[model samples]
Every structure is written in C-alpha cells, then in structure tokens.
Target: MTDTSTDRFDFALLQSSNERTERRNRRLLSWLLGLVLLAAASIVALVLYLQTFEREEAERQRVADGQWLERMVRFHLRRLEEDLLALAYHARERQTRQGSVTDLPAPDPLRGGTLYHQPDVLLQHGWVPWDSSAAPMAKALRADAALDPENAAALAVMQDTARGLRRPSYAGPLLDAQGQRTDRLWLSVPLFERGLFVGTYVASLSLDQALKAAVPAWFMQNHRLERVDDQVVWANDETPSPRPRDGSYYAQLELPGTQIALYVDALKTRTPWLPRLFFGVALLFLLGMLGAVLALWRDIVKRQRVERELQAQVALRQAMENAVTTGLRAWDMEGRLLYVNPSFCRLVGYSAQELVGRSAPLPYWPANQSDELELVHRELMAQGTEAQGVEVQFQHRNGYLIDVLVHEAPLRNAEGEALGWMSSVLDISERKRAERLAQQQQEQLESLGRLVVVGEVASTLAHELNQPLGALSGFANGLLNRLQGGRIGLDEMPPVVDRMAKLADKAGRIIQRVNAFARRREMTREPLELRSYLLRVLKPTQRERQVRWQWDLGRIEAWVDADPGLLEHAVRNVSSNAVEWAMRATQGSDRAPTVRVALVRSPQQQSVAEVGISVGDSGPGVSDAQREHIFSAFHSGKEGGMGMGLAICRSVIEAHHGRIEVGIDPVLGGACFILWLPLVAPVTT
Candidate 1:
C-alpha cells in the first residue's frame, strides 16, 4: 500500500511541472509576436514619412528650377532691350549727321551679339521715320507688317506707346493671315535726340526662337517650356526623356517695362521605389537584430583604433606646423582674422592670442598707413585673392618696421565653399634693404661711366679743335703782319678782315659744340624736329672726318621730346664710332669709307609713335660673339679703348625713354646703331 501511494504522488508532481513549462512557452511566444508587429508598424510609418519628404523635395526643386528659368529669360530680354536702345541712339546720331532719314541703315536687333546670350531671333527690323512721306520703311518690313492688318495695328500701338513714354514698348503675339495668334512679338524703341522724338526703331521677334536660344540646355532637358497664356506645349526633341511624369511649374518673367509669364512643365519621370526599398531594409534589420548586437561590439573596437590613428595624425600635423618657418595667416570674408601660426607670431613679435580675431587696421599695421592697409584689406576681401603677392610694411611689437610679402589665396573647405582667405607672409626686410643698396650702387657706377666717357671724348675733341684754332691764328697773324708792314690797303683790309671773321666763327662753333656735349647739367626736355636736330649733331662729326656721308631724312618730319645735351652726346658718340670704324676699315682698301645717317619715323609701338636715328658705316659689322656684352661697361672691342662709351650711350638713351640697338646695315654693309625715341606730336604754330 505504501509503494502505490509513492508512485501516484510522483506522477502528479511530474504532470504539474509539465503544465508550468507549457504556460511559460506560450507567454514567450506571445511576447515575440507583439514585438514583430510593432517593428512592422514602425517600418510602414517610416516608409510613408520618406514618401512624403520625397514629394516635398521634388516640389521645391521644380519651383526653384522654374524661378531660375524665369530669371534667365528676363535677363536675356533685358539685354535685348539694351541692344535696341543702343540701335536707336545710333540711328538718331546718323540722322543728325546726314541731315536726312531716307537712307537709314537697316536695324540690327541683336547688335550686342553673343553678349545677349541668344541667337538671331529677329524676323524683320527697319527704321520707321516719324513722317512716312519723308522716309519710308524697308519693303520687307512693310510687307511683313501688311501681311496681317492686326500686326500693323499692333505695331502702330507699340510705336505710339514708346513715343509717348520715351522708352521701349512691346506688342503682340502678332496674328497670322487667318487671324490666329502666332509667337511673334513686336518691339518699338523710340529714337529721341535732344528730347525730340525723331522716329521709331521697330523689330519683329520670334518667341519660339528666343526661348530656344535663351534657356539653357540642361534646364530644358528636364522641363518643357511654353507660354502661360497660350499654354502651347514646347518639347525638346534633342534629348531623350529619362522617365515619365505629368507636372507643371509656373513663374512670371519680370521684364522691366512689360508683363510676361512663362509655364515650365516637368518632364515625365518614373515613380521612385525608395519607399519599398526602405521597407525591405527595415524588415532585414529586424531579422538581423542578434547579429547586429555582435557587430556593435566589433564596431566599438574598430572606432577606438580609428581614434588612436586620428590622434597620431593630429600630432604629426601639429609638429609640421611648428617646424615650418613661413608665417601662415587666415581671415574671414569680413576681414576678421581667424588664425595665425607660431611663425607668424614670432615674425610680428606678438603672440597668436593677440593677433587672431583682429580686424582691419590691426595693431601690426603702421599708424600712418592704417587707412591704406584697411582699404587694401577691403579690396582683397571683395576680390577674393590677387595673382601677385602684396608687399607691405608691418610694425613689430618692439616698434621696428618689417617689410613683409603676403601672398593671398582663397581658403575653401572640402565642399568647395569659400571660408575666407589664407595668407603666406614672409619677412623681406633684408631683401628690401639689399635692393635699395644695389640701386644706389648702380647709380654710382653710371656716374663713373659718364666721367670715363667725357675723358675719352676730350682727347678726340682737342684734336678736332686744333684745325679751326690753327686757321684762326693764321688769319689773325697774317692780318697783323700786313697792318704792321703798312702794305694793307682799305679795300684789301675788308677782304682780310672777312677771312679772319670766317675763321673766328668756325672756331666759335667748334667751342659751342664741345661745351654742349661736355657740360653735365640737369635734363631739360624740349620738342625737337628730328631732321634739324640730326643735322646739327652730325655737322661737327662730319667736319672732323672725311668719310663719304649719306643723308636720308624723310620728308615726313619726325618730332621727339628729348634732353638736347644728353641726346646730342648719345648721337655724337655713336656717329663718331661709326666714322672711326669706317676710316680704319678703308685704310688699305679700294672702297671709300662711307657713313650713312638717316632719320625715319618708326612703326607705331603700343599706339605711341617712335623716331629712329640710324648711323651705319662701311666697316666690319658687329659679330655674334660681341653682341651680348657690347653694351656692358669695361668691355671693349677696340684696342686701347675705354669700354664705357656704349654703356654710357645706353644709359643716356634709356634715361630719355628711348632704346638703342646694333645690327648690320643693308646699304652700308656694316654695323649700324639705331637710336629709337618716342615721337611727339608736332606743335602747331
């Protein structure tokens, strides 16, 4: 009896346990079903929300595109109107000058050309005079207007409106022969001179042609354009449609003096499957929740590793910035300072804290130059950046001025959005000082060269003076001997005195030429007839040498503004050298030494005319090897020569804003030196 009771109790316990297990399994299943339902509902809600957002976005884009198209059309129209006004002004001027309007030139509607950003849309254009009896329109224009009585009436109304308002007026959608509306627009621009209406300039425009030329290809690819009033569908046949849709965008083209509207229809587009795609992704996400938990831990480990690498890159960049010596600076569009590197702080003798965030007319700018610097800053901000660097003076914190060269570049982010300006500043005080010192040294060298040229010329000048002085002395001595011997008669004395006077005059002329050349004086520029000046300068040199001189001063007189003394010296040196070389080359040859001097007007240079003084000789021409250093100081081809002559000549010519060059003369068959000076306008007396 005890065994039976034990067995029955065990069985009841086992059954209760099994029932409890079944109840727990059922509750767990119910909870899972509820979670799955919630997930599905959330996914549906998200899909609907995305669909709504997409519709809003598309609507916004369509509206924006319509506005842009309207702006483009209006801009083109504005340009066309400007071109028409210009044509009217030209017509008025032509009538005023010609004193008649009967033969006015045909109007050019698209006078501004590509500047109007449209193709030729004009069908007919002509000048319409105020009085039809005085001047009639072209036959073509007249015929076009007469094709339909409505067109003529519309043109007349537009002309009357333009005349009354003293501005341009538009009329039509002109009617066809069947009295049906066409895409033709008539523009009447009134021609007014001195507040009096002279006539009307009229043009017929094809609206369809205008639209095709004005709208961008990219815009037309997605939108079909049409007139708002007519609702005529205009489709682009060139580009294939990407999808299919039926929508329209509307915008008003706000012309300055006219009311016009345009209708832009969105092209056919396929319905987006983004909502369905989102729904599928959401379902997959719910199914992979356990995998996502594992992935989250792995992602956290990868994020930590990436953070460590980013910190290392940051440290490396900081080190590079510190190592760089060039001063780096940054500023915003408003001219407010944004950043400064350590090198910049060291250069300005100021800390980054004191320099960053500073605006224009900062502490580093010199007090007296603050206004100028601020103006420059404003211009830089407006223009973005300069191709060439700006050189400026900056004051250090210790009260010393530093010459700095700052190169500016537009600072942009990864998205190509302009942040401000980035500048690379370099301290150039030492370079500036060196440049000034070199300039001073060059001036000193030039002065010394002048002195050497004078010394060299003095020897030759004394030899030239000897002949005239000897003649004068001989004449004086002969006359004195005759008077002392009492052999001179009164008639004879006149002839003798005349001879002495001639010699005296020659000697005086030689002295005057020498004084003019040798005297060092400040530059005194004067307008000179080049022909006359060349004659005077070459006379003394010709007399000194026996070379066959050829003169070819053109009839068209060339004039120049030059310093007389300096110009004379340069001309004399070049001519003298030519004569000397000719004399030497012809010493043992059968060829007679010849020197050709010519003055001719040179071709225009940058709109400024120039006159060339060419001196050619029959001696050996300059060789290629010597041409490079021929004008250098202390470089001479002649034996026992002071090489400063050509150098000094070059300096003098450059001072007068002229240039000198050497080449082989075709006529003389020898080296030729040509001095070119800017020609001046002849003074009318």
Candidate 2:
C-alpha cells in the first residue's frame, strides 16, 4: 500500500509541473501579441501624421500658386487698359492742336499697327468719329473684319451704344447678330476733349486666344486654367476639369468693366496611393509574425526604422528648401527672427547667422526709414489677418535699398495657435525699374510726337519763305539795273517800281504768316472766294518756278470758311510738291512741269453743295506702298524734301471737317490729290 501511494504522488507532481509550464507559455504569447499590436498602432499613427503633413503642404502650395495666377491676370488686363488709355491720350492731344474734335485726323494706319494687328490678339479694331448727325459717328478705320452687309447692323448698334453712353462701354460677343459663331468680345473706350465726348476706340478680342498667349508655358505644365463656368481655356494635360478630387484650389478675378466671374484652377501633384498600400501591408505582415520568436525583437527594430525614416524625411525637406530660389524667413510673435533660408540670406546680402535671432532696429534696416519699417512690422504683429503682400524697401548689407514684395502668413504649431510670421520675399527691383523706364518712355514718346509736328511746320516755313524773298531780290535788282543804266522811261519806271513794291509786300506777308504759324498763335477764320484764293496761291509759285499752271475753275464761284494764312500755306505746299515732282519727271524733255488745279461742286452729293479742289500733276504716279504712308510725318520721297507737305495738307482738310484722297488722275495720267470740303457747318442731330 505505501508503494502505491508513492507512485500517485509522483504522477500528481508531474501534472502540476506541466500545468505551470503551459500557463507561462500562454502569458508569454499574450505579452508578445500586445507588443506587436502596439508597434502596429504606432506605425499607423506615423503614416497618418505624414499624410496629413503632405496634404497641408500641398494646400499651402496650391494657395500660393493661385494667388500668383490672379496677380498675373490682373497685370495683363491692366496693361491692355493702359494701351487703350494711351490711344485716347493721343486723340485728345490731336484735338487740342486742331481746335475741334471733328478736325482731329485719323492716326496713320501703319504707325500703331502692332497695337491691333498680327502677332496680337485683336479680332478687329476701329474708330468711330464723333458727330451730331443721325449716326452721330462716322467710321474712320476698320481692320481684320470683312465689310459684309450682315455685319453692318451689329456694328451700328455697337457704335450707337458708345455714342449714347459717351463713356467707356463694352458690347457683345458680336457673333449672334452677325450670323456667325465666334469667340469675340468687344470693348469700347470713349474719348473726350475738354469735357466733350468726341469719339470711341473699339477693340475686339478672343478671350481664349489672348489668355493662352499670355500665360507662361512652364506654369501650365502642372496647372490648369479655366473660366468659372466650366470652360477650360487652356491646360497642360488638356484636362477639362479636376472636379470631385483633392488638391484643387481656385482664385477669383474681378475683371474691370465686366460682370464676368473669372476663376482659375491650380492642380496639385497627387500623393501616390502605393505608399499607403505598402505601409498597410507592412503593418499586417508585422501583426502576422507576432506569433513567432522573431517578432519580439522586430518591435524594437521597427521603432529604429521609424526614427530613421523620420530623420530622412526631415533631411529631404531641408534639401528642398535650400534648392528653391524664393527667400523665406520666420519671426516670433515678439518680432525676434526665428529662422531664415539660404535664399533670404543671399537676398539681404547678409549671413544667416547674423540675421537669425535678430529683432527690429537690427542691422540691414535703411537708416532713414528704420522707424517707418519698425512701425509697419509692429502693426503687422498686432493684426491677426494674413498679409496678402506689402511692398517694402529693405537696405541690403551693401547699403542700397532693395525692393522686396513680401507675402506673409501665420506660422503655427499643430494646435493652430500663432507662433510667428513667415514671409516669402520676392526681389522685384528689375520689375520696378522696368515700370519706371516704361513710364519715362511713354512721356518721351508723347513729347516726340509734338516735336514732330513742330518740326514739320518749321521746315515748311523755311522753304516757303525763301520763294518770296528770292522774287523780292530779283525785282529790286531789276529796278536798280534799269535806273543805273538810264534806260527806264517815266512810264516804265512807274510800272517797275510798282512791281518792286508789290514783291516786297508779298515777302512781308509771307514772313508774318509763317511766324504766326510757327509760334502756334491763334488766327480767325475768313471767307474768301475760291477763285481769288487759288489765284493768290498760284501767283508766287508761277513766278518762283518754271512750272506751267492750268486752272479749270468752273463758272460757279463758291466761298470757303478758312484761316486765310493756314489755307494759303496748305494749298501752296501741295502745289509746290506736285510741280517739283512733275519737273523731275520732265527733266531733259521738251515738256514743262504741268500742275492743274480744278474747283467744282461734288456731283454725287450736290444737295449739300460739297466742293473739291483737285490738284493733278504730270509726274510719276505714287506707288501702292507709298500711297499708304504718303501723309505720314517724316516720310519723304524727294531729295532734300521735308515730307511735311502732304501731312500738313491732310491736317488742314481735316480741320475743315473734310478729307483728302489720293488716286491716279485719269486726265493727267499721273498723281492726283483731291481735297473734299463741306460747304456748310456739320449738322447736329
């Protein structure tokens, strides 16, 4: 019985030992499982944090891009407005010189062709001259549009609106009314002189074409530009829209003089889903391995790997920050500098060590404006709103003022509390210089235009006065010869002396008129019969040159309203040019230079009794190319020619509410210039 008891006790002890071992094993497995779960949770949290950081970064980038795009759009639009304003300014100056809006001549078509022609985005451009008649406007010029009957009504409507408003106005797409579909938008700029509405300058544009030509090609590579109404005007990838997706930002543009809601979309680089997938798979793999002995140390190994990855990410970010050219700096709420990038140091011409931790009243502030800059900084700190941008002058280490456009935002911790201000500084010194240069150039151009007009008058005065002086010298010499030779009888002496006095008087009048014109003195209008004026103008030219003059002044005598001095100058200059050219063509030939002047009432518009003075010469006809720019200031075809004759003639005709046209004379078989004049004052509606 004792031996049996001993065997049972031994078996019980063995069983108890087996139970303890099993319990220890189960507890160890539970501990390992907990460790694996903890590591997996930590990794998941890290991935989520990384993803959040990336998303925030992308959002910030998108906002910056959108703002930049908006600024660019505004800049270009403003530039276009400036062009229109410049044109208006030119028109005003012309009106002021001519003394009336109706007298303001059309600009030379070739002068500003680039402003509305090829290599530009204009679909069409024109001028509607102001009048008070039923139309209240007359078409002066048109480009890039066919003069089809269907388009007449639409054009008339546009002009009527401009005249009615007497201010800047925008019309239509101009497609439906014209029975055609096109992306044409019209803009009209009303011109006023001395508070009177005088005219309108109309321009048409294809919006998409214009925008595509303006945006930088590089910028479009990663972004898409579109209107707010879901029309994709331009895009790099030809994406119609990026709706219902992440990382898309919008910028609103309030275009001037229009109710268009313009918006631009900036697409961000998408975060790859592959990384998230890999991370998830890694976490699952780690969880599956937790039942083995290797997983115990894997928890520790995974922690080390996470730390290494974080360090790598930080290093990568630092590298990226340094690679960019944009200057970046941070300041604490107390206005102490917290950090600065390499670019910022380079921009200020200072070292990062010197700038970081520096506060207001620090180095690099311009001595004269240090207080002002400090005040601005204080104001910025006091305000919680983000700064869009501020143009500030910062003194470089070399002591020159640096023009910097600074954009600032609040730099906060993950809790969203403001820590300090972060700034991106853009060096816009070159752009500022360009703007100044452009302004100066514009002023110079205006001054140059006035000078050109003055120069033309001065040149013509010198040439025209010489003729009368030469005649006076000849007559005086002839009378002296007759008296000295003792061959002048009493009758001959009286006639010769009379002729000499008349020549002297003619010389005096020429000098007086030229002086008045050159000095820009005002003169009064005088009524003179056409026959008398033509005879007076031709007398001097006939005696001064060997050219033959023919007159076809019809019996019907008409009186003209004109400044006698100005009128005489215009007719004489043109006739003199015609005679000179005719002489050149007839050189070494028996034929003498022939200049024919004819006056007649317009047959087509005789109801108004419109009159025309047609001057024809037997000279080489003007070429098509020359005909276009013959009236342009400083354009000359003759040796030692001032090239101001035709230009002056044009100005004079326009001043009288008339127009001059050039064509081949059917009778003379040479150049013919016809000056058309209204017989009465322009009727007002």
Q: Write the per-residue lDDT of candidate 1 for residues 3-115, one digit (tens) a residue.
A: 67555323222221245545665575567566767887897888788888779867877888888887887788778777877876777778767777777666444548433
Q: For model 2, what is the alpha-carbon lDDT of residue 331? A: 87
Evaluate candidate 2 by giving its C-alpha RMSD to the native, one decimal: 47.1
* lDDT values, one for every candidate: 0.76, 0.69
Write the residue-wise lDDT of candidate 2 on 1-685 in tens digits: 3567555323222221245545665687679777778778888786887788777766777788878877776676556655665676776567557756555566554333222443547765544546533211343223222344434445555556666766555443334434553445566777776777776766777766656665677777767765542232323344445442444555665543433333444554757566667677777777566645465455545544555565666666698789988899898999999999998888889898998888988687799988898887887677633556888888889888888888878899999999998888889999999999999999999788768756765776666667667776887888788789997878777776787778778767766765666555676676667776888878978897788888899886677777877777778777887888899999999987888899867787356667888888999979999999999867789877667678767877777777888888777777988888766443223
Question: In model 1, where do residues sit more than 4 Å from their true spots?
Answer: 1-315, 368-379, 382-388, 413-418, 436-454, 457-685
Number of the top candidate by lDDT?
1
Candidate 2 lDDT score relative to the true structure: 0.69
- TM-scores for every candidate against the unseen true structure: 0.39, 0.31
How many residue pairs clash per model? 5, 1
Clashes by residue pair, model 2: 132-685
TM-score of 1: 0.39
